[model samples]
Target: MVRWLLVLLMFTGMADAAPPSLYSLLSQGQYQPPMQVMLQLEQNYPGVITQFDIDVQNGELIYEFNMLDPDAKTTVGFAFKASNGSLLEQKVAKLESDDLEELAAVTLMRQKQLKFSQLITLATGELDAYLTEAQLDHDLGISYLELKLLSAAGRHKLAFDIANLRPLPLLKWD
Candidate 1:
């Protein structure tokens, strides 16, 4: 039993370096068949790179890359019996682009739940008569406010809580 476990610890777990962070991949991608780029990321990252939503920023198209690193033991996790250490369950989130809000807004616009009309209403009080609008409603109820943020022109930006961040898995309970 110990021998089999030993093999797995050394050979598997760490796998590869996760196909270069989505930020690096997308940044290097040319203005070509964008869909193909996304497909490649999805295929390469699988459970990690879950969503690729695009938006326009200052007239240039941008993408918000969403990833979910799965929960798994790494190659170096410590074997309690052996008191040995291994790299287990390595997870660290990353942001690939500076214009995350612009990308997120565009993503939010395509989302079914984020209606432009409601966004307009919400903006009436906080903002002046609208020159443009966007909405992002699919966020977990806790981050629901992020939807409103994406819609406002000149103010669209994504600011997430890094410390409390949780994986937004592609899987759903409902």
Candidate 2:
């Protein structure tokens, strides 16, 4: 199957590798965790913080936060300077109905006290994998966390329920 072939290519190192995690930068003690800033923004703007990542631009670490603002019905991206957690840039786009549904699921997930970073930590610890990225995803009315990971075996895309951290039926490279 084509999916099998893609998984094979990923495991064989033929696929593009993911960027390093923002956690590594935190461990280095040179940069503050951008989640705090994200929380602050969420409080001010009242939105769903959906994804977080660190991007290197011109040799500088840029912490990016993606969220959905319900009142405004917009998807927003906030880029912050890694060192001081200062806002660098913000981009906003209109959210479609599908996005609103995902946001609703994520909001319910928050009621259950699910944190994306905590899930990544628990999963990586259990699987002995390195976390590359975690994003909120919805498919066929199922809301899950899509985790991109790297390990000695290979790159893997694992999915887990947003509320309970239960593993979902997803592709496994190993």
- TM-score computed on alpha carbons, candidate 2: 0.64
Tens-place lDDT digits, model 2, residues 116-139: 556555555567554556778776
- In terms of lDDT, model 2 sits at 0.69
Local lDDT at 148 for model 2: 75
- Go through the candidates in order and give the clash count of each: 7, 0
Worst 10 residues of 1 by lDDT: 74-83
The alpha-carbon lDDT assigned to residue 45 of candidate 1 equals 47
User: What would the per-residue lDDT of candidate 1 be over residues 1-174, giving only the tens digit for each residue?
Assistant: 988887786698654344443333334444443334334444554233333344443334443444432232111111011011111233444443442443344344335343323333343336322121122223333332222122322334332221223222332111
In model 2, residue pairs whose N, Cα or C atoms come closer than 3 Å (at least 3 residues apart or on different chains), thus clashing, are none
* TM-score (all chains, Cα) for each model: 0.24, 0.64
Superposed Cα deviation of residue 85, candidate 2 (Å): 0.8
